[model samples]
Target: MAALSKSLLDAKKDKLPAQAAEGAHVHSSGAAQVEGDELWDKLPRTPADILRHAIKGAIRAFTLAYGARVTLAFLLRLLAVLRKKDTILGALLAAVRSQDGPRFGAFFGLFAFGWKLVSHSLREIRGIDDRWNDFVGGCVGGLAILAETPERRVSYMQQMSVRALQAIYASLHSRNLVSIPHGGAWLFALTGSQVMYAYMMRPETLPSDFYRFMVGAARVPDPILRYNCTNVRQGQVDPSIAVDLVRRYKGTADNLARAQGMSATPGVIPCAVIHPTSDSCAETNLSRWLRVFQMIAPVYASLNIVPMLTLRLKHFLTAPRTLASKAIFNTVRSSSFLASYVTIFQLCVCLHRNLHGWVERVFGRRMADSRALVFLFGFLNSAAILIEHPSRRVELGLYVLPKAVDSLFRIMVQRRLAVVIPHAEVAMFAAAMGAIMSFYQREPECMTPMMRKLMRPFFGRY
Candidate 1:
């Protein structure tokens, strides 16, 4: 009995040490976990960190924008060289050469500086922790577009305006007020600029474009000048008008044969000068409306018997889409902005044609361009614009009035001053389509040959 009691005591003593060690192990693990969490909490979320991340995002954005611009310029330059329009290593050599290389460097700087400023502002607005990954990756796109508009094309005043406007847009995107998708950023900028230019800013103080319009060849893209081909001064149409407008008018029925290829120079093509009439208002109004009408004509140009397919595709690959693409989806569903605008435009156009027919029956043919007739036509166009999109006319008004008022003001008041900004954003918007005309001029065969001819002044017909 004594031996058994001693053995039991020894067994119990050994068990206590093992149990205590297990408890100590668990405590050690818990202590280690607590310390790990404390270390994480102590890490800094400093302004320096935020700026570093913001800069990372800015650098990424600038890299993409600059790359795209440089690539485009390189391709264009290469094409020119290949076509024998330029020297063999013209752009390629210029890309490396110190003096010539500065153009691209400046081009790169525009986006880099613009985005860096935008990113720092955005970092504060979003309050996002700086991670290696930039959440707003490449959001500052379209910077290349600004660069594409050659420095020569943009005046200082216009550049200032654009910079201010672009700053607003970038800030909004950074703040997420204007989201990346659905063109919200673009919409905001467009609306804001319109308001600033029309109501807030006195456009009259701005420099004039009419003098340019009157003395220089009518800008080929001038809707009033391009469409009617009348009222625009003869020989004053930019020579590019020959390539653009097809020389619709002739000196007389007998002179049609001699009018072919009037000339390759810009603003030199013969077009009818506006016959001085009190109804110039109607003519101007009608032409402006017609320009917008043509812009939306594309959607109606084709017919699709089964439009529902677009919706099914949208439901499939759910990546981000464009305004036009979203419109396509809505179209397939039987209702969309496109459908609404198309229906309205078509109905109004038909009504105008019917009304014109009635007028022809009542009045003589010579009254076609009469003030009353032209005014009615202009009113119908205005109605179509309202019907298609309620805000469209207001947008157009905002866009044009500022310039019109400014130009008129300049002509009457600041008659001697140069263009306030050689070309304002609104002016650029109007001439956006004409910007493509540069492709023709850039093309070696089209422009380089002519340029060579001009350069070799002494060698005739070379």
Candidate 2:
């Protein structure tokens, strides 16, 4: 009888369902069976569900930590502004208006003076630091070349192109470029900002606010939670309600970061390796340009406002200081302030000219002859530069401000509006570029085999 009972028990145990299995039967009363079914139903949570919960929790934790820090920062700035009777923004605006005409010229003069001083100092310091001397020397050489006429500009650009090619060659041979991590803190900040923006601006597209709220309220054991949410099909969500949530949340983090004047690709290391092929080079250029635009757009958009704050602060705080110290600080600040503007101006001009020439090739019409087209192209180029210059200032302002204002304004206003507007502008610009390439430029043949070989590693994979 004992052996028979053991055999029956083993058979029953073998028939039992796995813990994660669904619809396991229980030999019990109907109520007990229903209870067992309920327990079993709770056990089969998918990994995707787990991941979703985890991501949601991570988002919350990040927002809390980041939001707190930003709030604290904004609060400090508010306090400073308040101590001045809320006149800071107005004063800054007034200062900008007053200095608009002279600021650029003033910045240039200061830059020239600094360059002279740096050059002299470096020459003197050459004995102690040869590498520094070489770098300064190279910069001086580049500047000298740039000072030449328009005809010489092409030659200078060509020379730079050659140098860039050689640098790529060296980097390829060394294999050092590929091993180095490209993006760092800036990247993290940018990624965080992107995520934040997605979440905040498009909250409806993400999971339900109630869901997030519950997770926050539940005090769940795991730091993260996973939930199985509906997926989109052709931009349509099965339950239209949930679809709206994901879209809303998709880029909320990015919007928040933008409000704070952070770059999505911050801390991206400069690319050193050059692809030997034309296709690879083009790909590399595209990637580099995208990164540059990402970094540049916000700064440019905020330029008009940034200079005002800097100038106002300088005028208000340093008015009592010695003229020499004031002048020194002003000179240093001015040059650094305008560096982005100068760089962007140069880059845009170069790109515009190149695009114009390329357009001329395909259309068989001189770009210069069409005044309207020229003006339109010129305007777009200028707009691009303008948009790329001020992002840093806004970022700096957010960083310096106190937390309370930061959180409130950033969450409610800047993240929702300011960031999205600029991004739209960037998207438009990209679309315009694509249209121009498709319609205006002639399709070229594939690069040579040797060039292909060289480019394969760097550009081909992408």
In candidate 1, list every pair of residues with a backbone clash. 231-274, 237-267, 238-266, 238-267, 239-265, 239-266, 239-267, 239-268, 240-266
User: Model 2 residue 459 lDDT?
Assistant: 16
> Listing every candidate in turn, what is its Cα RMSD in Å to the true structure after a full C-alpha superposition?
21.1, 31.9
Question: lDDT tens digits, residues 392-453, model 1?
Answer: 33333333343444444455555564445543543453232122111111121222222333
TM-score of each: 0.31, 0.17
Per-residue alpha-carbon lDDT of candidate 2 for residues 1-462, written as tens digits (9 for 90 to 100) = 334434533443355333112222233456656665465444213334333433443333333333333333333344447567666565444444543223322322332333233332442333121224323433442342323343334333433333233334334445555432322223223332332223323334333542363233222111112211111112112233222333334424333333234222211101110111112333434444444444433333333223323333465455535543544454444334334322333343335434644555676453322433322332333222223224333233222122222233444564475342432322332232222111111111111222233222211111
lDDT of 1 at 297: 34
- How far off is residue 178 in model 1, in Å? 23
Candidate 1 Cα errors over 4 Å, as ranges = 1-51, 63-316, 319-325, 329-380, 390-406, 409-414, 417-462
Candidate 2 ranges beyond 4 A from true positions = 1-98, 133-462
Computed on alpha carbons, the lDDT of every model, listed in order, comes to 0.35, 0.32
At residue 347, give the lDDT of candidate 2.
43
**lDDT agreement of model 2 with the native:** 0.32
